[model samples]
Target: MFAENKLTDDMAEIEAFLVRERAKVLSEAEWKFRMRGYGYNLRRTNGGVEVARLPQNTVLGTLAL
Candidate 1:
């Protein structure tokens, strides 16, 4: 028991968003570079490597090196 028209409109909006922003999507490296300016760093984890945001003071001090 559901409204079919409501579901159709929701799906249409999602499709439209994907189509419009398809070209604006960033590559993995691009994303890393962009976020790096905000104090994020890549680190090794038990499972795999991941990017994390460090404390502002610590990041700034490291960058001064």
Candidate 2:
């Protein structure tokens, strides 16, 4: 649905969309901290930083497929 050209990659676009979704879900402080790490940090907390992986084909909500 977001193809800009005939050869555009849909999975790349979908990944970008998911990144945007994750950004939107984070708080302002969390966003700033995350941006400071060059988008490397996945789990940010008072305990410690931990990298996390999301499952494939995972639905976020009723609005998400």
Of the candidates shown, which would achieve the greatest TM-score relative to the real structure?
Answer: 1
Q: Highest lDDT: which candidate? A: 2
- The digit string of per-residue lDDT tens for model 2 on 1-65 reads 22232332344553454356456755746653543343322444554333322323222222122
* Cα-based TM-score, every candidate: 0.32, 0.27
Provide C-alpha RMSD values for all models, in order: 14.9, 11.9
Give the Cα error of residue 37 in candidate 2, in Å.
29
Cα lDDT for residue 27, model 1?
61
Model 2 misplaced regions, further than 4 Å: 1-9, 27-65
- TM-score of decoy 1: 0.32
Candidate 1 deviant stretches above 4 angstroms: 1-24, 43-49, 54-65
The local distance difference test score of each candidate is: 0.36, 0.39
